[model samples]
Target chain A: MKARVFIRLKSEVLDPQGQAIESALKNLNENNIKNIRQGKLIEMDIEAKNVEEAKKSIENITVKLLANTVIEDYKIEIE
Target chain B: MKARVFIRLKSEVLDPQGQAIESALKNLNENNIKNIRQGKLIEMDIEAKNVEEAKKSIENITVKLLANTVIEDYKIEIE
Candidate 1:
């Protein structure tokens, strides 16, 4: 199965990179820009006998290292 | 308008971060992992008199700085 791991900053977290982009946009005269956030998406192919085990593995990896639980959230999609 | 900038490495480019994650997963005994590719998603809100101008601004920014065109592909989603 193929899985996609999405790692994003928690809503309350401050994102400096996003802030820089926003500032750049402001320099370009793009108006009313707000709440810019950046995130990561990792796509991988994995093998499992069934869907459940695949999900379990992805979930485990997500919590273990794929995302920083204190300031990030993650979601997985199976394809 | 709101736009999502989806940036992924071109298929021919190697992604070291993805490789490291794959290696980590292998160390954990996860099986059949391959071709892990990591990418970025940036979400932002902007204002324009109309959709076309917003799209134009986003495209300009994307080409100018949001992504490295030589090795990345970007898609913009307007909302």
Candidate 2:
């Protein structure tokens, strides 16, 4: 199975990278966007025996390393 | 309209962040993943007059600042 992980900054935290990009857009004279936020997406292909095992493995991946618990939240999709 | 920009490292380049995460997963004893790649996703809400204008605006953003053409490729999705 393949798992896709989307980890995004928590709502309460400041996204400096996104802000910098927005400022660069302003400098480029493109003032059409009202807002933008940036985050990370991780795609993984696992050689698990079954879907349940794949899900369980990815759950541990997210909790341990893929997603930072302090400043981010994650969503996992299986295919 | 909402435009999502997904910028990812070019396939030729090594993704150190992804490698580190995968190794960390191995250390955590979850050994089912075959491969992983990480990238950035930027979500933008634009209040443009029309779709074409919004697209043009984002194209400029991507070409000029959002994506580094040398080592990354980007995909734009509008909603």
Candidate 3:
């Protein structure tokens, strides 16, 4: 099975990197863009028997290693 | 409108950061995971007339700034 994990900073956290990108875009004339935020996407193959198993394992992996629960949130998808 | 841009390295490119993560996972007893890859996800609001226009603008921004065309590919989604 293939899994994808999307990890993003919590809504209340300040993202300096995202702000930097927003400013850069503004300089490039992308005035219509707003509230720019950046996140991480991790794709991996898992040796699981079914979608449920893959999702469960990926969720565990995400909570333990992929995301910092204190400041970030994560979602997992299995295919 | 809201937009998301996913930027990933080309298949042929090597991802050392992903490799490091994979090894770390192995050390942490996640032996079932393999072929790990990492990418970027950008989320933002777009002041466009419609989804089509938002997607088009995002594509342009992705190609010009978010992704390195020579080594990465990007997908844009507008909602």
If you score just chain A, what TM-score does every candidate get? 0.91, 0.88, 0.94
* TM-score of candidate 2 chain B vs. the reference: 0.90
Across B1-79, the per-residue lDDT of candidate 2 in tens digits comes to: 9898888899898998888888887788767786688999888888788888888888788888888999999888888
lDDT of 3 by residue, B1-79 (tens): 8889998889999999889889989877989999999999999999988888888889888888888999988888887
Estimate the Cα RMSD of every predicted model relative to the unseen true structure.
1.8, 1.7, 0.9
- As a whole number from 0 to 100, the lDDT of residue A72 in candidate 2 is 92
Q: Please give the distance, in angstroms, between residue B65's alpha carbon in candidate 3 and its true position after superposition.
A: 1.3
Winner by lDDT between candidate 3 and candidate 1: 3
Return whichever of 1 and 3 wins on DockQ: 3
Best by DockQ: 3
Judge the docking of candidate 2 as incorrect, acceptable, medium or high.
high
User: Best-fitting candidate, measured by TM-score?
Assistant: 3
Per-residue lDDT for B16-36 in model 1, tens only? 999898889878877576789
Tell me the spans in candidate 2 whose CA falls farther than 4 Å from its real position. Answer: none
Candidates in order, TM-scores: namely: 0.89, 0.89, 0.97
- Provide the lDDT at B34 for model 1: 77
| lDDT of candidate 3 at residue A76, scale 0 to 100 | 90
C-alpha lDDT of all candidate models, in order: 0.86, 0.84, 0.90
